[model samples]
Target: MLKAKVGGALPAANEAMMQRAEAAIGDLRQNFKAWLEEEVGKLEALMRTARTSGIEGEAGEALFTCAHDLRGLGSTYEFPIITRIAASLSKLIETPEQRAAAPVALVDAHVGAIRAAILQNVRNDTDPIGKALAEELETRVTKLVGERS
Candidate 1:
């Protein structure tokens, strides 16, 4: 009798099942893109409200939460540049004190970066314009946060 080796290879039937499952999951990309677009719109709205109403209290917290969520989802949806922009914004408004004292201009800069990245279809971090935009936003945010401290 032949003995099956542990942790060697998947059986033929198991491999075929895995391939079929992968193909089925691949078809969900379009649906995921649609959902991501809707989520981004909601995030944009939240940011606008924070900008107009002043970044404080519930509005500020909501904006921060949205940015954080975007940061996590950006790479998953093939938008690494968005991840970078959102990460910077999240850092800028991480603390309540930071949010309360955050300048409107700084907040607007972050929101604008996010909007531009999405609208321009900047999926890669290495894209020349995307790189510049991410760097500029990160630098400005870092400077502003430093000044606050």
Candidate 2:
């Protein structure tokens, strides 16, 4: 008697599923720009709060959360450059202790870069300008906090 594989579907089935998934993603892509803009607005508002309340208490924690969210969502929004920059920002203030020590200017710069990346349609590191800005921000963050452990 013949037996099927225990753990997976046939290649043809997998390919069909992948095609469907791609179509779904294509449909979602139409909304990605608006979604990305909304997320950036949230980040900006959080940054404003951080400006007044400082980066140690609720405002700082919220800022980090927003940055973390943006880092995760950036590529989904077709803006991998935002992901890189937001990742840097998230690393700079992931913990309360780090937030307390984090420089306001660095935080603001990261936010600004993410905003600019979206506004300028710099979607990924392929753009030399976006790549350079992301790398510079990452370098500064590493200098202050070292690499992620």
Candidate 3:
């Protein structure tokens, strides 16, 4: 009984293609995570500065848009940390009372905690895009805080 031995399970070429596809998907995930982390850093810094000095003019508008964008992205990606942080931020400005009472120190501490969580607990498939972005945002945040003060 000449059982034509065709290769196991997947044909070699098909297996190779599938492997490539998986690798491509992995690459895509890495890129997306990198992008999201950069975005988060930017949002955190903006929040920090706005909280510290009180946002104003075009910057205030930009900050609000940034918060809104982060919430939408966070919701889409199912990043619980991002979603919660963004929700807290949005609530701070949701109503007049909330906005008037929200404290700069509170926002800074909460966001600082979240940033640490992301840096320590969250693992992105890519390299340290988050690290680079965090550093850049850190510098900008310091400068903004100083300016506001």
Candidate 4:
């Protein structure tokens, strides 16, 4: 038998596995991004209604309902960030005091965190919920505190 080349097969196999993994990640990122953009549009509309129609009003309720529906959809996709924010914003939508202004900043913070997660590929598997949204709420609360000072 001719001498076999021992190392020759390993590189090709490793490359193929890496390619498969990258492709899978790419698919998740692309699909998740598309879904997130759509969800963001919905969230923006909800916020606008909460601001304009009055979060306590019937219009705000309708918008909140839409947001809740979106949250449910996100849950189906395991998009915990969207789901958590939608839930938190539901309470804010229902409240609609001048205090509701707080969640506006909260929404902004969530947007920033989402952008970061996308860029860094940081998976929130430990909590599986609400870390980004909580950060957002804290940011909003802090902003409100700053405004008062």
In terms of TM-score, which candidate is strongest?
A: 2
Error in Å for residue 63 of model 1: 0.3
- Alpha-carbon RMSD of each model: 5.8, 3.4, 13.4, 13.0
Candidate 4: tens digits of C-alpha lDDT, residues 24-126: 8667775766776676666666666656655446655666676667567654445665565555544444444533454454544544454454455443535
Q: 1-149, model 1: which lDDT tens digit per residue?
A: 13455656555677778889877867776776776787688877887787677778888888889889988988877788878888888889988998987786877787787778777887877789889878888888888786433
Model 1, CA-based lDDT = 0.80
TM-score of each: 0.77, 0.90, 0.51, 0.46
Model 2 spans > 4 angstroms off:
1-13
Summarize candidate 3's per-residue lDDT along 49-127 as a digit string, tens digits: 7765675434445555676676677644535555555545554444444445555565465466446646665332132
Over 104-141, each residue of candidate 2 has an lDDT whose tens digit, in order, gives 99999999999999789999999999999999999999
Alpha-carbon local distance difference test for all models: 0.80, 0.92, 0.55, 0.55
Using TM-score as the yardstick, the better of models 3 and 4 is 3
- Supply the TM-score for candidate 1: 0.77
Among the numbered candidates, top lDDT falls to 2
**Residue 20, candidate 1: C-alpha displacement in angstroms:** 8.0
lDDT of 2: 0.92
**Residue pairs in collision within model 4:** none
